[model samples]
Target: MTTNEHINSGEWPLWEIFIRSRQGLDHKHVGSLHAVDAQMAIENARDVYTRRMEGVSIWVVESKHIHASNPADAEAFYDPANDKAYRHPTFYNLPDELKHM
Candidate 1:
């Protein structure tokens, strides 16, 4: 398969895709598959993952390139802060007439 054209055509590595079904919600990891290029990856992800209800947007990243932190560093990775009130906008009273965030 090394020197063959057929195998060479399928050389592009696999990728994992994430999809955002709607606004205001975090992107969720959908699944993974192979493609010849990035554009094909997106199209393939749509045909494979979202053939039914579908999503608003899609993201495709090479599965081999994803770097994740060790789970053993959980405490140091995501620690809660005591004075993070400013990070949240809950105290501000937004207009009730507004339809979207």
Candidate 2:
């Protein structure tokens, strides 16, 4: 069946795939796939997006479960943080013993 036909058939749910290449790294969205369930989605994502074993971990989330802010309201929602200079650490004076920080 064509891609559109398969999607419209409702036989599979769309999943968003995220991969972490190594330990301590954040999982980044790579792509998406369609599957019958979460386990199948995870397996399919690993196979499709990590053929060369680039990822040490994978996460598959149903597209329907994700909620995101509208891009148009980004400035109104996030711009307020930019005006708060005290939230930053530029003025902080750490002790000499805190060299790692």
Clashing residue pairs in all predictions, respectively, total 0, 0
What's the TM-score of each model vs. the native?
Answer: 0.57, 0.80
Candidate 2 achieves a global lDDT of: 0.85
Error of 2 at 72 (Å): 2.0
Clashes of 2: 0
**Candidate 2 TM-score over all chains jointly:** 0.80
Task: For candidate 1, write residues 3-24 as lDDT tens digits.
Answer: 1342377566778999888653
Off by over 4 Å in 1: 1-11, 71-101
Instruction: Give one digit per residue, the lDDT tens place, for model 2 in 26-62.
Output: 9999999988778988899888999987798999888
State the displacement of the C-alpha of residue 28, model 1, in Å, after optimal TM-score superposition. 1.0
